[model samples]
Target: MSALEAVIPTPQVIERLPGASFKPLAPAYVRIPKPKPELQQEAIRIADLLKRNHGLDFQVAVGGTEQPGDIRLEVAPVAGVPTGKEAESYALTVQNGQLTISAPRMRGWYYAAQTLTQILLRSPEVPACRIRDWAAYPIRSLHVDAARKYFPKSWFIRQIDRLATLKINQLQWHFSENEGFRLESKKHPEILSKSYISRQEATEIIAYAQDNHVEIVPAFDMPGHLGWLLRNHPEFRAGEGEYLTRMLDYSNPVAVAFLKELIDEFSSLFIGQTQTWMVGGDEVFPMEWIPKELAKRTPQLSEYAKRNLGPKAEVLDGYMYFLCEIDEYLRLKGFSETRAWSDLLYITNLMNLPPRMQIAYWTQWSELMPSTQKLLERGHQLLNVSDRYFYYVISNRDDCAYKKHVEATEILRNYEPQVFSEKYPSPVAQARVLGSSYAIWCDTPETEDYEQITRGIWPGMAAMSQKTWNPSVKVLDEEGFMSQLYLLAKRV
Candidate 1:
């Protein structure tokens, strides 16, 4: 059978004729009714995809009325759908040489369009199919840390569009860090001016991400990794002491106010009823730095640390104080999620946190699985972003892993059932395991060959996605799965 026949096999020919004359469907004509901004955009995108893949011509129309066509879309509005609803609730009926999709909201319409697109992509000869699908995870997400290395706005938008195609609904944008801050914060102009390439570039990227089905969750690394911010505003530092490169002074109310204002500006720009802010509370090193700074300014700190934490515990005591203060400030401003590397959980008393607060466990070390178990036992939600499974940067480049001399091929080989069985499946893991994310750390992924990076990561990440989506799915036969990947790549 030919490629077209293989994708769209005819039951009658298979049963009786063995080989029969068959003609594929003609170029599709799509008519969109009551098209809103999002629905229209989705329809256009679907049309473009069809044209690119199958040489199908789509004639699109928008109104409250109906027209004779191969496919018809009716877009309407609904009330009960959650905030930032991007799809419509549509009913599709195909009969008598025409297909129709009717929905009450733009989100529903967008969803219906996506279903149609998938059907067409999967089978060119089949013009009709029925599907009723919505997102399983309410907060389907992707997290990209631009602070480690900045990706251009166009590149960011391309990633967003690709995720939207896969039905992934959110983009957690790590916008600021010690290495660089990418967003245009109103309170701190110097954040982008001193750190990023340009502020206009950041805004344009935000707009592009929004245009796709992804919501951008802006993260600003605070307290521990605020060195870049402090470099610009020396007054924000805890002490005259030059360890300012390491930590911020939470004892200073001025510094607290700075964070509050930064969050407020982020809320105005990105956060919404459905989307939330991620104040990164991870990788806070040199715990003693803050207490020492406070010791010089406030003579009481020395006595306080000695009395409460004992002499040896002074550093940790000070770090915990900073974490608590930052968490409180974010809560006051209506932020819901706070992400930190797994190490933070072991060192900090994060149990009994506010209900709005959610933690992201970035598995950097082997101990992260145990830390995740501990946090889950304390009744907290977590996003699993393990470097072994999800770090895309590591998979892409040969230079990233010197210890193993691992290339993409080696990374893919190492990611078989052995790794999953031995390392990933800790004792007490469950569905509260919200999802898995592959980190595209900017350091290694600086080149234009992002497609190769994506290829190396996807097959392995697909295993992770299956594990997160359905734990019962077995990790057997890597060769079989790799063959599937090659077939999928050829089709695309």
Candidate 2:
């Protein structure tokens, strides 16, 4: 025997003991010990998957049964589930021809289902074993730039399922950029498109994500990536000429208010019991003021900007102040967790920033461990996306951003958690890491090669999932990972 094995993000513990094993799942009926609406729906989804993959009539049973095809689910906390950190831990025991999964939370049970589904694909039979598993980071996020380019509705839902199988619990919805805003709002009817997700469709996507154990963290990059929005509403744009730059005019109070209104709309749709919001404060390299040198003359604006913000009240300072105001406003409007690019902390002089807003540290090909350490020192939690490692590339090189082709395997192996661990060895340092989210940016919506993109998402996403789930993890067996990938493809 090749020893007891599990798929990507190999389990924490797997012990084999001599006993009767399930030769096959045995025409099983999946049952829940108690009525859990979420648990029942997840069980049904996985059972339906098993039926499709292996031609097994794995019926979904709501309550316990002693019949032959019995796979009972029990809910309870893992003996030592972490209190301070979010825990997605579960225990599965297969003994005496019965398989039972126990979890402390609904998410745990759903993850346990994913693990078992993979095991089934390898063999209908499971050795008499006990497996205990939990995620290393509370947030394993995947970022999709639907703002720059849009994807089909089915694409997002299928992606939710695929990400869940890899145990990614969050989807960072980057739905606004310079190219387009891929959401429909009655207030902003001018920007609506045939391809945009309607209000009704957005609601459906949210529901689908919840059922599949995923949280959608929605984002609309402000101030900078607003070419499309500013083009439509030229009064809000920063620079002017026959060829006006697309950046939003930060010194323009009307423009600042316009961005806030968009945030209000974004919050109304995304904020529920558990959604998060982010304002992108990245790549504001050019210092563009609407009036060119308005701050140099306006004492009131420059005084507030200089006093509350840093001392040097320049164009960039105004931009930072504007972002901080929006951040605080979103926080006041019930978004306790506001996120922005780590550049807000690294490059800008924006002081008295909302310390509570989580930072997503991503910069291409630059060593950000120091930046992450800096953020941690200031008591800020961060998600280590570190763009170079998590970015996905299209084969055709047809997108506006990336014109060169990159392999999915390279993207998969580009990152490791060791860098951060080595940099910050203390317990406090460890906890400040929110988790990692890989970005798959698409700048041109029209010319995407679906096959190439889908292939990249599967194995590459699997690699990211495994690394973030267990930061110390490495590809020990190439063949084993490939085998796992094949099975995962069937489910995806």
Quick one: best TM-score, which candidate?
Answer: 2
Per-candidate local distance difference test: 0.52, 0.69
- TM-score, prediction 1: 0.69
Q: Encode model 1's per-residue lDDT on 249-269: one tens digit a residue.
A: 665667777877777777666
Candidate 1: Cα lDDT at 453: 51
Q: How far is 92's C-alpha from truth in model 1 (Å)?
A: 7.3
Q: lDDT tens string, model 2, 1-492? A: 133464667776777867877554456788877676777776787676566556667777878554654677777877554565336898878888778888877777777877877787777677788888888878888888887676778888889878888899899888877778788877877765456888788888988888777898888777667777776788776555422356666667777787787777868777874546878877544323333654553444466567665676554456567777887788777888888886535433444356687888764223322355566656678787755556664434544344443444564465654333223433335567777887777755555665567676676677777877875555667667867787678768
lDDT score for candidate 2 against the true structure: 0.69
* CA error at residue 377 for candidate 1, angstroms: 3.7
The C-alpha stretches of model 1 lying farther than 4 A from their native spots are 1-69, 73-122, 127-129, 132-136, 185-187, 193-199, 234-244, 286-328, 331-334, 346-351, 364-370, 394-431, 443-492
- Candidate 2: regions farther than 4 A off: 1-4, 23-27, 36-39, 59-65, 80-86, 241-244, 287-304, 307-315, 344-350, 364-370, 395-414, 418-428, 444-447
